[model samples]
Target: MSGAAIALEGVARTFPGGAQAVRPCALVVPQGEILGLLGPSGCGKTTLLRLIAGLERPDPGGRVLFDGRDVTRLPVEARHVGMVFQSYALFPNMTVAGNVGYGLRVRGVRRAEIAARVEEVLALCDASALASRRVDQLSGGQRQRVALARAVAVRPRVLLLDEPLSALDAALRERLRDELATLLRRFAITAVFVTHDQAEALAIADRVAVMRAGRIVQADTPRALYAAPADAWVARFVGGAADLGGVVSDGSLLLPGGRLPAPGPHAPRARFLVRPGGLDLADRSEATLVGAVTRATFLGDRLRVEIDGAAEGALVVDAAPDAAAAPGARVGLRLRPGGLIVVPEAEEAP
Candidate 1:
């Protein structure tokens, strides 16, 4: 089945006692593309999904559309959208095949057709061999595969995944994450996946929408978001330990030790962001900082150095493990032009 187009216009949700769970949020998911809603806990990613599924009503004027047709008033069953929750949510007594076939049977599909469709999805998920096994007997990854197969067995126009990988072990989660991405693309299904994991969203989403306090702060390709965050909050959230602090003045970085040409455009009074990988130990007269290595850790191909004398926080630089400077040795640090992200200063930068 071809993918459906999804649009949310001014969708908002307000809980009782004056809690605005979701602001007026708008987004469009094109046919055959994956859009990820990424944020920390209590950011309303699940609430937004429930809104689109018709399980929760939008505040007064909000609307949800699928394929350019208003579906705000339609019930969940009428929308033909498939959902896979964090829990596999399979019936306890059902075998793998039975769980996968339940949805088809609900729609009144013929008995023979339900069997054929179940077999088809089982093969797609590489779980055909486990068709007769009970859900209780399946491993975590196997259960996830069965859940996904059940969602797609009815040829849904749109798919929604709510933290489906959060329950698995790290290795299984990674494997299933890749598998899910491939399956979505192969079926050409429009999908919205909600996750609190930065790596998971960056790895699987075609475009990621970073949410904060009930609103979308930024939406862009993963590389772009990491390389160029719109503000300090986004930079800190997406960049993790890579967030660097510096002041900008007259097209230069006024670092603690010295000055260097600012990497990007910035307000006269603005803070700068530099990724750890963007800073290197370079020999230059204009290098902004001179710090003594207080600690160093070998990280496979790279070394993480903790330096003192430049700023209050550690200056983490990536270098060849063998090239790491000796502890207590002084090193000059330089910021690469492409490494900096200039954010306008606000009491609280958006």
Candidate 2:
């Protein structure tokens, strides 16, 4: 089955006690596009995903449409959407093949057809060898593949996954992030996933929607979102290491620490974000910002240098692995051409 574009028009969810878990918002997911709902805890990303899956209903006047056809009132089963929960939720006693075919069986598919579909999905997920093995006998990675196979075995119109990789250890999760992205593209199915990890969201999804306090603050491609964040919080949350704010005059930000050649619209006062790799340690005579190195750690390929008295608190910068950086050493830093990002003033800036 082909993918369907999804639309949420003024969709919001309010719990019984009048707590608005999700504020009214409109978002569109293009056909076959993988959209990531990204935010911190209690940002309503999970609730929004539930509304799209038909697992939760929206408040009155909200609408959920698949390819412009309304499906707001339909339950999950009728909506023909597949879900993979954070737990993997596989039946411990069931074999891989059995688990993958469970959805087909629920829909009264014939035994022969169910077996054929299960085999196809298991191969797609690279778990064909585990077909006869019980889910409980599989490793964490194996379990995840089986869960994904089960969800896609029936070829649902849309696939919803809630933290599908959160169960794995750090190394395993990093290894599987790319695999999941490849699998989604191969499936070519409309999919929406919930994730709080920014790196995962950027690497896996075609676009990311950043949520805050039950509202969708911004939605854009990973590159656009990083290069041009809508505000200070988004900048800090994405990739920025420090926030520096002061009056900008003649293309320079006059901070207490020093002057930074920040190019942005002239404002009486402005704030700039220094992304971690955006600052380079330079000679004292040519440096724009100066500080004392508080801590330095060699991060395999490069050196992570944390400096104090730069802007406010510690500002981290990426230096060459062999660079001379040690605690208590004074250092001068120069901003790269695209190093600083100018953002609108907000209380979130520190």
Candidate 3:
């Protein structure tokens, strides 16, 4: 089914007792694009999704549009949006085919047409063989596919998923993530999914909107978001970059261990984000920092080395597996050019 473009203008959500769950936000989902709402729990990603789905009403002055048509007042049933939840909410009494055709049947569709559509969607989701299986008899992955087929069987204008892979184990989640990406593309449906897992969002979404507290802090393609975050929190949350405090002077940043070349002039005291891969063991003569290795762990393809007496306390680095540095060994660290991300330091509280 072709997808519809969705737009949210100044949408906000506030629950009873004066708790604001989502601040005023504006977003747009291109036709047939898969956008991911990413953030920690309590960050209002789900609330935003509910608003778009008409499961919850937004505060005043908010508008939701589908292909430029205002849908702010539309109820969930009237909006023609399909949704998949983390629970795989299927009817235990129904067979896989029954579950997939439930929406069509509820709308008084012809029996033969419903059957054909169910078979079509089941095949699309790679569940054609399980059409007659009972819900309880299916595996977790099978159940997930069934849920997806059911959501898409109705030819929804847009699809929404809330933590679709959160219930699966790590290995299964990884496997399903790739499958889900492929399915979303195959369906060519405008879809929005909520996820707290950064890897899942980055892997499955065409663009990711990173939320914080009650607002969307930044939204961009996965590669752009990883390469250049909007600020310190985005950097830390998106990729777990460590903030190393330092002083900027004469185009150099002076840290506890040593100084590295900086970009433009900034405040005397500044904070810099260093990704784990930014630091590497180098010859002493060309080193930018020196420290004693406190821990070394082999991570299959690479070695994770933690060092003390570096920037402030322990600094972690991803090194080549064959590097000789071990626990208690002193090593020189080379800072890769353009790896240091300067971010605004937090304001001091009065």
Candidate 4:
């Protein structure tokens, strides 16, 4: 299926009773790519999707575009966008085939054409055997597939998904997340998905737009964003960050374990960011700081160890499972030069 380019220009929406949602926002989703709108609850992800879908309109100058054509004032029905809700809104009375054919039927398609489309969708979902089954008989994952098949049956210009996988269990969600990612690529559809699941967004999306408090904090590829977040919020939001506070003096970072070279652009006394994997045990003879391993968690192939390094605080470090010291073992930290992420010093107490 062909995809459409989607763009949002200074979109803003305010609901009744003074609930301000989706502050003036501008984003462009390229053709044939999935862009995830990800954030915590009430962060305006859904509001942004609604603005693009024409379900809710932004005030006068807030423009929406499809393939560079202004469609800000177009009604929802006229926009020809496909939307899949979190609930998988299939009618209980309708069979799988019937549910898949609903959109085409609404467009006044002939019975023969509707039959052909339903079969095509059933083949697409690999649910041809369940075509006659009622929605009540299908499992959670099956229902979600049906919902996706229904959304794409009519060949929409753009597909909007609102937490489509939240309803499934952990195992199924993970499996179907991969399936959905493959399906999106195979179908070549332009999609904007709103999700609170960071892993889901990071895994499936071609690009992720991280949202915070009605504003887009950052938008970038998964690898670049995770490796180098634009700010502290993006860093912490993406994963649990272990902060090691230190001061820069005499052209080196003053850490618990002697002075070390600083990384990146920053002022003195900046917070250096390091993922657990960025550290290793420094040779004892060269080590200047000492700490005991307080805890160790074995995660498959690696061990996450929490060490109280120096007076600053306990730091979590990742080590090979076979290489980890026992709990309460005295250990020293070795910060790699490129592993440090430097941020400016916080404002002085006023």
Error in Å for residue 4 of model 2: 1.2
How many steric overlaps does candidate 1 have? Answer: 0
Regions more than 4 Å wrong, model 3: 265-270, 344-350
User: Which regions of candidate 2 are displaced past 4 Å?
Assistant: 267-269, 346-350
Q: What is the per-residue lDDT of model 3 for residues 1-350, given as tens digits with 9 covering 90 to 100?
A: 48789999999999998989999999999999899999999999999998989999999999999999999999999999989988989999999999999999999999999999999999999999999999999989999999999999999999999999998888899999999999999999999999999999999999999999889988999999988887788888888888777677788778888877787876444578888888888876789788899999999899999988878757888999999888999889888766787766655211
Best first by TM-score, ranked: 2, 3, 1, 4
Instruction: Choose 1 or 4, whichever is better by TM-score.
Output: 1
* lDDT per residue (tens digit) for residues 66-114 in model 4: 9999999899999998888899989998999999999999999999999
Error of 2 at 276 (Å): 1.1
- List the pairs of residues colliding in candidate 4: none
Identify the leading candidate in terms of lDDT: 3
| Poorly placed runs, candidate 1 (over 4 Å) | 241-245, 263-265, 283-286, 311-313, 326-328, 346-350
**Estimated TM-score per prediction?**
0.91, 0.95, 0.94, 0.90
| lDDT of every model, 2 decimals | 0.83, 0.89, 0.90, 0.82
lDDT for model 4, please: 0.82
Clashing pairs in 2: none
Clashes by residue pair, model 1: none
RMSD of candidates 1 onward, in order: 2.4, 1.9, 2.1, 3.0
TM-score of 3: 0.94
Candidate order, lDDT descending: 3, 2, 1, 4
